[model samples]
Target: MALGTNTGGGGVGAGTEVPALSGAPLLGSLHDLKSDSLGTYLRAQQRHGDVVRVSAGPPGMRADLYCVFSPEGVQQVLASEAANFRKDNAFYQEVRESFGNGLLTSQDEDYLRQRRLVQPLFTRRRVDGYAGAVAAETASVVTAWEEALDGVVDVSDEMTHLALRAVARILFGTDVEATAEVVARCFPVITEYVLRRGYSPANIPRSWPTPGNRRAAAAMDELYGVCDRIIGQRRRAGADASGEDLLTLLAAARSPDDGGFDAAELRDQVLIFLLAGHETTATSLCFALHLLARHPEQQDRAREEITRVLGGRPAQARDLERLPYLSQVVKEAMRLYPAAPVIGRKAVAATRIGGHAVPAGADVILAPWVTHRRPEHWPDPDRFDPERFTPEAEAGRPRYAWFPFGGGPRACIGQHFSMLESVVALAMILRAYSFEAVDTEIPVGAGITLRTEGPARCRIRRLDGPVGPR
Candidate 1:
C-alpha cells in the first residue's frame, strides 16, 4: 500500500529530511514495513527528525500525511486543540461499517451522547466491581492450559482467546467458549477489512463485491447477528435488572436529555466494546509474554512478586495494588509494542501544532510508535526495562510521553479494565509456568492493531508446585 499522500505543498524544509543512511529512502517503503508499522515510523524518525511527510495511496492518487513524533506535538494532537480534529474519514468509515457507530467511531453529538451513556460502566468504581469476573475468566483459561501439560503452545492465540472470553463474559454475561468461537469467526474479517482500507482507499467501497470484501461483509453480518441474539435474549429474560455488565449498563443508560439508546445504538455500543476491549488487550498480553520470555531476569522477578502476593493461588483485583512490578512489566511491554501504534486525525480547521502551521484538511498522524521510542523522552528507549515506569522515574517525564491507551476525551474507556486484566493474567501465568521464546525470528504484523506475524511459539515449564517460591 502507498503510505499516504503529500498534498499540494512543497516539502516544509529542505534541511528537515535526515541524510540518507546506507542509500535507504529518508521515508521507507510502506509495503516492506507492512507487518511492522511502528518500525517504519521509527525508521522515518531516525532519518527525518520529528516530522516526515510520506506518500499514501496509489501513485498519483495519494494524500499528503504529516507525521508528528515530538512530545509537544503528540500532546497537542491528543489533548490541546483536540476539538479541531474529527474522526470522520476513510479510516474511521471502515471502522464504522464494521463495528457500527459505536464509541470507537461515532462522532459529534452521537459520540458525545453514547460516551455519556457508556462512561459509567467504566468508571473506576464500576470497573473494580468486575475484577472478580476478570480473575475468574483468566483462571479458567489457565486451568485449560494446565491440562495441556508443560508443552509448547502458541501464547498469542491463547492470550487472544483468554481476553476475548473475559470481555464476552463481563460485557454480555455470556459463555466464554461459545462467544469465543463467534469472535474467532468475526475478528479476521474485521482485521482484514481494516488492513485493506488502510493500504488502499479504493478497497473501502461497500459496493465492491470481491471475494475478500464478500467474506468481510459476511463476517460482519455474523458478528452482528450474534450480538443481536444476545441482546434479544437479555431483553426477553430481563436479566439486567440491576445493570452490572456493560451491556446492562448501556441498556439502562439515559442521555442528558433523558433520551436513551435505541436497540440499534445499543447493538453498536456492544459491538465496539466486544471487539476493541478484547483485541487490543489480547495483543498487549501476547507481546508482554514474549518480552517476559526474552527477559528471564525480569520474568523471574515478576514471578517472585506474584507468588509472594497470592501464595500460588488465583489472583484478585486487590492483589493488583501490591503487584507494582508486574504492572511495570506490562507498561514497558506496551511502550515497546503498543497495540494501536499509530493514531490519526484530520485538521477540521487551520491550526498550529508544535508551532507548525497545520493546513485545514491535512492528515495528522500521531504515532505512539515514534513518540514512545524517542531517545530524549525515554532513556535507552529500545531496551526492555520496566523500571522506566516506576512512579519516581515516570514523574520525571511529560505526561503525554507514554500514552499506551491514548489520551484526552477520546482515550480508551476500558483503560483500567485492560490494565487490571493484564496484571492479573501476567501474575497468574508467571506463577504457574516459566517460559522461554523459541529461538526464532517472530515477525511483527500490523492491522488495526499490532500482533505477531507467526505463532508466538514458546516452551513452558511448570513452576515448583503451586505454593512454592515464585
Candidate 2:
C-alpha cells in the first residue's frame, strides 16, 4: 500500500522528494533489476512505497528510473499527464532503430499518422473477421495433440507456434505457411538483441564486428527480406486485399492526410504486427492454461462455462461475450503473468507523482506486474481467483488497477485482437481436453515480450465422448 497522502487536485502539486533504493554502492539496483526485474520492482514498492527512485550504473553513466506503481500514479503518468511523458527514451529509441518507426515506437506526428491509418484495421468488427483463421489454426494444434495423448505437451512452445500461424494466416491469406516458418525461425534473435541493447547503459554499434551485433543484423535481414518480398510481390501483382486478410487491408489502408503507407512503412507495420500480435497473445494463453491446470476446481468451473456456451461446437468470435467465466479466467491469468510487464517512458518535463517530485529527464517505468499484485486493490494478490474480475469487483476498482494491455492514448492497438484470439483458442482447448500441470511453475522474464525461461509442460487427457451437450 502507498504510504503517502492523496492530493485531490488534477494539476501537479507541491511534492516531496522520492524515497531512493538502498542498493549496492557501485551498480546500485542494476544487478537485481537485470536478474529479476519483476521481483525487484515488487520489493521496491513494498519497501519504499509506490513512487521509488532507483539509480543504476556508474557515476557518469548513471540512469535514474522513477518507478510509478500505484494505480493513481500510473493514471497520472500514462493518462492524465500523458503529454508530459513521451516514449523517446533510450529503450524506445533502440526499439525504433531495430523495428522501424512503426506504431509501437513511433512518436509525435508519426504516431498520430500511424494510429489513424491502422485503427480501422483493428476495429472490433474488423478483428472479428479473423476468428475463423484463429479457430482453424487452433484446431490444427489440438488435433496434433493426439500424438501426445496421455502424456505431456509443451504448452508454451505450442501456443507460440499456434499464435504465429494464426496471425500469419490473417496477415497473408495464402502466403501464411512460408511467412510463419521464416518468423518462427528468426523473431527470437531480433527480440533478444532488442532486450540486450535496450537495457545496457552503453551500446556497441550494430555495424561493428561483434557476434551479437552480427546475429541481430542477420535476423533482421531475414525478417525484413521476407516481408518486403511478399509485399513487393503483392504490389507488383496489384492484388487488392478485399477483406480476406490483414496484409491486404494494411496495404490498402489510406490516410486522409497523406494516403497509404509506403513500402518501408508497410514493412514497419507488418513487423510490429508480428511482434505484438503473436508474442503477447501466446503468453496470455500459455499462462491461462497453466494457472487453470494448477487449480483443478477453477479449471473445471471454466470448462463448465465453455461447455455451456459452446455446447460441443468449436468456438466462434460471437461466443466471446457468452463465456463470461472463461474471460475472467484469462483476465486473472494476465493479472498474474502479464506479457508486457514493464513499460518505459521519458519525462517530458518536471512533474509530481504520488506526492513526489520527478526530474525533467528521467526514465519512468509503469509496472503492471507490481501494480496488479497490489494487495489493496486485489486481496491475496498472488492467488489465481478469477472471481476478482467479476464485473462488480472490477467496477469497484480503479480503471488502471488491472491494465495488461496498458492504458490511455498509446495503449496497444491490437488489444481487441489479442482478447479475441485468447478466448476463442482457450474455449476450444478446454472443451477438447482436461489438463494437469506437469510443471507447476515456469520462470518467465520480460524481453520485447514475456519469454518463458523454463519449460511449461502439461499432461492432457481427451474428454470422453463430448465435454458437454451435443
Candidate 3:
C-alpha cells in the first residue's frame, strides 16, 4: 500500500459526463468563484447533486473543475486512489513558488522523503510535551482579553495571535520572542498575495513590477530573513540545540540516505509549519469559542467539564481526554467551519467518481465544508449541536464524512497538535471567562485557510478573579 491512501473508497464514475453548472459561456463560473467560493460550492452540490463539473477562465485557458462533495468520493480522491489525483493545481503552484516546496506542497518521492525525515518531529508524544506551552500561550491571550478596555473582545484576531505564539514557542523555543515580530508582520501580506494570485485566471508573472508583486516579494524576503537568522543561530549552538525545539530538530534530523534538510529546505519546512500550524488551529479555536458564545447551554456544559477536570489549575495534555464535552465543541466547530474549506487536486488519470467520468488532467476539489453538512450524517447539519460528535453518533457515519484534517497519506501532519492546542486553550479560556457572542453570524472566506470576513466579537465576562487556579 502507498503511504497516504486507504483500501476502502467509493466506486469510480460510470464513464459519463457529470453535471455541469450553467454559467457565462466564456467566463464560466469565474465571477461567482471570486465573490464566494465556499458558498458557490454548497450551492453547486445542492443544485446538481454530489458530482458536478465546473469551468472557469476564458476559452483558451478554461479550467474544468470536478467537484466531489460525497464522502465516498472524498475518500477515493484523498486516500483510496490517491495517486490518481495530485496537488498539481494552480493554488499549490502559487504556494510552492512563494513558500518553497515544503511538506505542504511537495510530492511523490520528495514528499515521501520529507515525510520520513520530519515525521518524528511531530509524533504525538513530542507534541503532547508542548501542552504547558499551549496553556501558557492561552493564558497570555486570556489575560489580554481580561484587560480589554471594554468587556468585548475580537475572538478571531485574538485566537490567531494565540495560535501563532504557541506554535512559535514550540517551534523556535528561546528565540520565539526574537522571531515573532517578523513572522507576525510578513505572513498576512504573503497570505493575501498567494490568495489573490492563486485564484486569478491571468496567472501573472511574479517578476512583473505590479504593486501586489512588490509587496509580496518584500514580505517573503523578511519572513525568509528572520527564519534563516534563527536557523543559523541554532546551527551554531550545535547538539545542545538539536532536540530542544522543532527548528533545532529540523536542523539535526537525518536519514540513512540523506544528510538532513539543508538550509533552504529547513526554511521551507518552518514556513509551512508556521502557516499551517497557526492558521488551521486558530480557525478551529476561534469558531469553537464563537459557537459556544452563541449556544450558552453547550458553552456551560463544556465549561462544567473543564472545571470538573482541572478546577482552577492549568490544563495539561491529559486534560484533553478528561474534557470530552469541550472536545466535542471543538470538533463541531471544525466540522462547520473547516480550516481548509476546499482542497484541490488534479486528476492524473481518467477516473470515475460518484458515477461520473472524470477525464485525466482535470481539476478536482474535496470539500469538507460541504460534506460535513450532509444531512444524512448530520441531522439539522447547520445547528451548533455538540451531540453530533458523541462516539456512538460518530461511529454511525461514513469515515470521510467529517474530514477536517483531510485523509490518507497526505492528511495534515499536525492534526494531533492542532486538536491538543484547541482543547487545552479552550478549557483554560472557558474556565477564565463566559462568552456571549456580540456578532450573531460571521461570514467566512477561504484564502489559504478559512478566514472570517467580519469580526467574531464576543462579550466576555470574567468568571474567575486571578489568572491562576480557582
User: Which ranges in model 2 have alpha carbons more than 4 Å from their true place?
Assistant: 1-14, 239-243, 465-470
Q: Judging by lDDT against the true structure, name the best candidate.
A: 3
From the highest lDDT down, the ranking of the candidates is: 3, 2, 1
What clash pairs does model 2 have? Answer: none
Cα lDDT tens digits, model 1, 167-270, are 88888775455666888888887878776776663554676898887888888888888888777765665643664667777777775584887778888888
- Give the per-residue lDDT of model 3 (tens digit) for 1-470: 00011112344446776898888887888888888888888888999999997777776666778899999999999999999899987788888988889999999999999999999988988889999888888888888776786899999999988999999999998877877778889999998888887777666689999998999999999999989998888888777664577898889999788669888999999999999999999999999999999999988888788878886688898888888888889999999999999899888777889778887777788889899999888889999999888999889999999999999999989999999999989888888899999998999987899899999999999986445432
TM per candidate comes to 0.91, 0.95, 0.95
* Regions more than 4 Å wrong, model 3: 1-14, 465-470
Error of 1 at 381 (Å): 1.7
- Which ten-residue region of model 3 has the weakest summed lDDT? 1-10
lDDT of each structure?
A: 0.76, 0.85, 0.86
Mark the 10 consecutive residues where model 1 has the least summed lDDT: 14-23
